[model samples]
Target: MTDLRDVTLRDGLQLTGKPLPTARKVAVVRELLDAGVPSVEIGSMARPDLVPPLADTLDLIRALDPDELARCWVWVATPRHVERAAEAGAVNFQYCLSASDAHNRANIGRSTEDSLAAMPRAVAAASAAGGRIQLCIATSFTCPFEGAVPEERVLAIARDPRAEGARDIVLCDTLGQAVPTQVTSLVARVAAEMPPRRIVYHGHDTWGLGVANTLAALAAGASEVDGALGGLGGCPFAPGASGNASTEDLLFALRPSWLTPSSFARIVRLSGALLDELGEPNRSRAAQGARTSATAFPWALGAEVSCR
Candidate 1:
């Protein structure tokens, strides 16, 4: 019953071998919206020189219509990033920063405190553009350079006065090292103690606990969760990080009200085609299981779904 924000285009394609064309990205977004996904992280405002694959984010933004843009999120770091993306018609901005100083510096080129200090301006920019903003805390669980991030560090960012106007707060396991217990504790604390904004869980599958941690976060009060098709994503800045939680797997497990059997089949086929086009392996067990010959299983894809 929870909302799944598919990050297939933004995070999923980050580590891919080739960049997807703007027309293809537009088609995928339309298909995803048609298939019932509530939100999609379509792209980022990060420097093109740093991540060449996502360099076309602004073009993709221009391709989507306003209604489509409303359901899509564009990742940003500073106020100017938000402003630029807003000019490109991005309505939802996910202003991101890591919980640790090292990872924050590595990922966004600034300290965690500096990122927090800029949130008020980022929020204002989103408001000025007549859109909404979400505060996204990366490295919420562990940082590649500094190791474990204390729970208090994440809480402080969430409770910061400058982060006032964000509509939601996303806690990210950038390195995928957080177990279910860690996810549960932090998510519960944020829900019970922090500002009354919605909690979002963004996890990676580095240690094979992405789904478990996601379930834990949901149980702890995360109404929305992020995942990528075929589990394709890794922080370019965070060494040792791997793919994201699988969107196909989450759809099967969560079974939100809008998701029908046909819709699930469509999502599976779409993910399969995209992964095949990129020549990437499918890391989603649920996605693999869905393609089984056993048609009797309710979760199994019927003969109609095939990317090959």
Candidate 2:
């Protein structure tokens, strides 16, 4: 079975244009963990002025138990973020950097080379603080302004990060432009150099291929897969970009083999409820179909119509 890691708090809040208060964040974190999500990316250490929702990340960490904090990972985009996370008692850190030149310049005010050069320092700092670090290689599939990232560029970045003491690396399809074949090929190639456990897949569903590409990654020997709870998040660069593959949707698609049907359906139900409360749309096909199915609520259908 592939390990699923929820990125709801980090990726979900990106470009949301709204701030999630501390109380709401705490509640959401508690709810996600209680749902048996296994792992949840709970927050980011990026600039608070930028990601205001996570302004209380330190407080959120303080409120969580050490054991609970161990299960919930957070992002650290720079050494400063790493220091802040360590102070907040986060155990696992995913240090992120954009691979696309345009994104690197715009998002972090640096070149891809500069970000790469700084990665070792970030990893070293996290290590010194006794935190596990994963270098997240963003925009592995496509870049909005650049478009069509070459395989060589991605492989080079992966090699450098791997050499920099990064225990794990994630290939992020930030723009959701990855095809199944490409996902399979890239994961397979990366796995050849590193252990399968060291590679993670972060795919988006922009073209309706998130779950398909995830299956491809697993087939290609990827051990970890990243997703969000209810298909939250959008690419700021790519217009109309959707969220990561919903955890519920991924489980549903992986069902009858990798996941039990009942277990998968339970998570889907919870995810649907969370989305409803957030006033967000349910983007899972299976979820929408189930909601509309006659068996969902016999009384509602009957109450609305008569067989006459």
Candidate 3:
């Protein structure tokens, strides 16, 4: 089974009007964990002034139990970011950079080469903090500024000597612009050519192909994928990007062992409440479908069993 890392509390809150309180964020993390999501990205180390919703990432990190934190990820764009977050009790780090220099500069205030050069240091910081790190390549498919990032540009970063110690390599569809064919081809190439590391696909639904591309990547040997609870999120830096792939939709399609009708109901309920708090519409088709009056459907949240 492909491991689905739910990014609701982190990426899902990015574009929302109000950030959830630290207590609420902690509760959401536990709810997802209780529901058996194997992994989650709870927050990022982006400049709080720039990304206000992510301001309390450190507080959430400190509040979580170490065991709970182990299965969670926090985003970082530099060695210093990783170091600071590690000190704040974050255990797993996703060191992120963009494939294109222009996007990297726009997102993280640095060149692509500068970010690549910082990888080894970030890896060392995670290791020294007794945690693991993953290399997350944003704009792996396309750049908002540059447009249509080359496949080789991404492959080169994956193959970079500095990226060696990363346990996983995540290819991000930052702009949600990649088609299934593009996702499949790149994932296949990386799986075949790159050294053995867990291949992860992080996609967006801007073009409505998020689920399609995720399945394609999984078929091409991606071991993990990312999604968000209410399909909330978009890059402030990358225009035209929508939410990450919906966790509700992915669970419905993948049908993981943890997703019983009852557990699914709980997930939908929690996401509903959380989305309501954020004042963001639930963009998840599956979540909306479950709440519909189609109670005859086995997958409906309102239907545990059929009366007929």
Candidate 4:
């Protein structure tokens, strides 16, 4: 079965200039869980100055109902962040490294080599702290500053994490420039080395191929995919990058047998509410089309929305 992890609260809200109240973040997460989303990246343990919206990451996690929190997976950037989150009861942690040196430097003020060297430490820390870890290879396809990244470069980085006991590795289309062909080719090559279930695809929708590329990856044997609700996420540090594949849109495209029509509608309504709350234009094509075709979206009609 294809597993979808909603990243709206963590990656989605990071770049938005406005900060979402902790209550709203908790409410959205609860809605997503109720809608049958298996995993949710509720917040990141990053510095407040770097991303103001996630400043209250710990508080947000604390506010979640224990039952819901038990069902959630959280993301963090470094071993230090992982340690903190694990102490606060986070069972899962995600750390990222860019395949392109230039993008790495621009993103974390560090070189790709330095980041790769630190993987073992990060994984070790997370594991020792009783947290399951997933490693993300950012700019796995193309980089905004460095252009196209070689598949070998990404594969080599993947080796480090895998060796450090990271069974799940997410290949990120940091700039959203990857085509389906590239996704299938690279994922196939990676699956040849690792188990197919160990691979995940994280895509953005800048070129409108997010879902297409994701489908290609799944066809190529990726076991999981990552998306944001309302398509609300972009890398503030990665220039030219856009929001991720919309959760509602992906569900609409895949029409998974497990998701009922009522559940689908509830997810779409929650996505619409999130779009309205962010005061941002609907980045989700599915949401926009639904609003246009039906008069049911009172929030979309009542408000003037602008894109980020």
Q: Write down the lDDT of every candidate, Cα atoms only.
A: 0.91, 0.75, 0.89, 0.80
Lowest summed-lDDT stretch of 10 residues in model 3? 299-308
What does the lDDT come to for candidate 2?
Answer: 0.75
Instruction: Write model 2 residue lDDT over 1-308, tens digit each, in one string.
Output: 56788887778767565566777777777776665667788887766786675667788877788888888888877777777788878878888777788876766667888877877778877888887888788888788778888877888888874336788888888878899999998888888877633888999988889899988998998888888877787655455567888777775555423344344555667667667666777777666655667376343223353321
lDDT of 1: 0.91
List where candidate 4 sits over 4 angstroms from the true fold.
161-163, 294-308
Candidate 4: 10-residue stretch with minimal lDDT: 299-308
Whole-structure CA lDDT of model 3: 0.89
lDDT of 2 at 157: 86
RMSD of each: 3.6, 5.9, 2.8, 5.7
Candidate 1 scores a C-alpha RMSD against the true structure in Å of 3.6
Winner on lDDT between 2 and 4 is 4
Lowest summed lDDT over 10 consecutive residues: which window, candidate 2?
A: 299-308
Top candidate on lDDT is 1
TM-scores across all candidates?
Answer: 0.96, 0.87, 0.95, 0.91
What residue runs in model 2 are displaced by over 4 Å at the alpha carbon?
161-163, 237-240, 255-266, 294-308
**Total clashes for model 4:** 0
